[model samples]
Target: MLRVLAVDDEKPLLEELLYLLRSDDRVLSAEGACDATGALRRITRALESGPDGADAIDVVFLDIHMAGLTGLDVARLLAGFAHPPLVVFVTAHEGFAVQAFDLKAVDYVLKPVRPERLAEAVRRASDHLGRSAAQRPPGAAGPPGPPAVPLAGPARHRPAPDTGAAPAAGSAAAAAADRAQDLIAVELGGVTRFVAIADIAYVEAQGDYARLHTDAASHLVRIPLSTLEERWAPRGFVRIHRRHLVALRRIDELRIDAGTTSVRIGAAELQVSRRHARQLRDLLMRQATG
Candidate 1:
């Protein structure tokens, strides 16, 4: 069972969310806050009360665009906590999905919210909490204890974020099957769409987030370009441009004109950066021969 704090400025939606959360068997308690400030206050109070006490919060389902402080700002603030509540962004906007994930969100649920989808987010959150508890040092303080006041080391050391790269693979076939591919999640017509790693034709960088483009559509996710480059290198998704990473298998033809080089994928032609052009040609030749 988990204690959840759901925050949203919209009254009816917030009420409905609380109802759905309360209905879940895994939820021990479901509380609500209209905005970031109130939610932070509740969290501060819970932490001050101590983790072994009654007021602890295990997770927070936050909305992105809020008055006063946005959910991103709130999550950033919470990241500094000694034991912060896990965040799950429940909002209508999909643009901020990548940024939310950068903040280490448990899950991103788009609106209009569905019972089943929210349930999935809760399950993920529960699993995260369990893993965290399992990894804690022996006899360390229990979960969800925050300082009511500022700590001496407010900037507590955080562990490293996982590199999206796959492990050493023996063969291409086995590698694809064993790769640690995260099915990029997207919301389409109120339904969640899962984009498989293999289906991606290419990736385009959008600042902090990366966009996954397939034959039919493109989906944005909260992963950096550099991270994807390292992670997908084993899978042959090569960096052609700073803003572009194309699947080597998807390349149709290589073009060079006026000393400029590019690769054609279907009808799209992406320029190959001067530094990477030679590497791309060599890899393509090796792939063709071997």
Candidate 2:
């Protein structure tokens, strides 16, 4: 679990960001500051209390454009600290990405924040924390520290290393979130493999776990079915039934027989619940016509 601070001058955006961060099981706590000054004050308090303290912030989701001191300024000031909270710049503009990286920001997120995008940022932050935690000597002193050096320049685009510290609970849906949002991590036999998101045809819920089905086989992961639904919604995975989530692009045909709704993906036919029938049909129709 990680402690997070979200800074955005817009009240609605700040509230929404806070809600999303707090909703994540990965987060220990989430707080907000409307501007750079307030964010700095809160950060100062947390730092003064010590890094291991209850109020310590592990990551800061900052808006790049602000009235007085911008998020970039804060990041620069943070770099001067012997220990600094990780910075993730949020902006509507793509122009500042280079500058943000130059300031050592771990991730850069664009405006009208998407849940999956923010989730990816959180995963990177978690990996940094995990890797740092693993490197620290046992029972060694002062607060769980930030990365010795932040990921910046082209290095920021590189995938995170396996921290080997019992990783994030997201399955195929979130595994892709670990880095580039293109591949999902799955453990098969005794070895872990990265599965392409484009290869997953559907996901089936099995108790507390989800099984990712591809062309050849299935892989089970510990993450919940609901978690995958939320994160993969943007990727075209939709709830066809309470027990099934199918990829829109993978659907071979939609079938309707005597008021029953079902979909065919390859040779497998899965029933679509009445509640999700309309939405699934709408999405599929759009996928077809658009």
Candidate 3:
């Protein structure tokens, strides 16, 4: 049985979500909150009281654009909870889909939420919880507690494109591969070879395709730079230009010559666009501080 909490500022939408969740046989109980604060309070009480607690919520159907604290804000807070509930963002807006995935949301359902879509989200959450329980350390009462605060770790998510099917939530290896493609398969002289993602210095876009640059050699693949950017950003790959994405760890130094900024990665110096310069600097600062 899955416990769910549906949070939204709109009373009618909140009610509709609660009703839909209750209709599902897998859902043990469903509750609603008018704001992030109320939702957080309920989650805190549940965690303090353990699984048998009255207000326990296994999954949260969060609304992205709430009145006070937005759904993202709420999720940021939950990331640190001792027992964080799986999140499933419900939104009419699609723009937050990438961020939702970055937060490791169980699912993202576009609003006016359909019963079928909501049910699918519940199934994924159940699968995830089951996997977590199975993988717990021997003799442990439960899975390890989450961070005391949301750590600024690298992103762990696949590309934002929908595949018409949810990924298998039971496989931890699958989740890891989604975040970082450890071995990139590329064709060299008509022979396919794998390159370690850690060895790649940077990626440069070549028309419809992108080329991965390593210390010794470069590999060109059919993947688009934008797609790689979306997938690898969490893995410390930052888009420094419209056509270039550089691995943060590979950057030797940032150089400013005649007011133009560029990053030196191995033997290559990739220029940074004005729009991405500040963001790159901030990311570097965060990485350094953390």
Candidate 1 structure quality by residue, lDDT tens digits, 221-290: 8899999999888877899899999888777656666778887776677889999988987765444322
Q: Which is the leading candidate under TM-score?
A: 1
How many clashes in candidate 3? 1
Weakest lDDT window of 10 consecutive positions for candidate 2: 147-156
lDDT of 2 by residue, 122-152 (tens): 9999999899889989876475333222111
lDDT of each: 0.80, 0.80, 0.78
lDDT of 1 at 173: 67
Taking all chains together, each candidate's TM-score versus the true structure is: 0.50, 0.49, 0.49
Q: What TM-score does structure 3 among the candidates reach? A: 0.49
Candidate 3, poorest ten consecutive residues by summed lDDT: 146-155
lDDT of prediction 2: 0.80
Query: Which tens-of-lDDT digit does each residue in 80-139 have in candidate 3?
Result: 655688899999999999999998898999988888888888899999999988897766
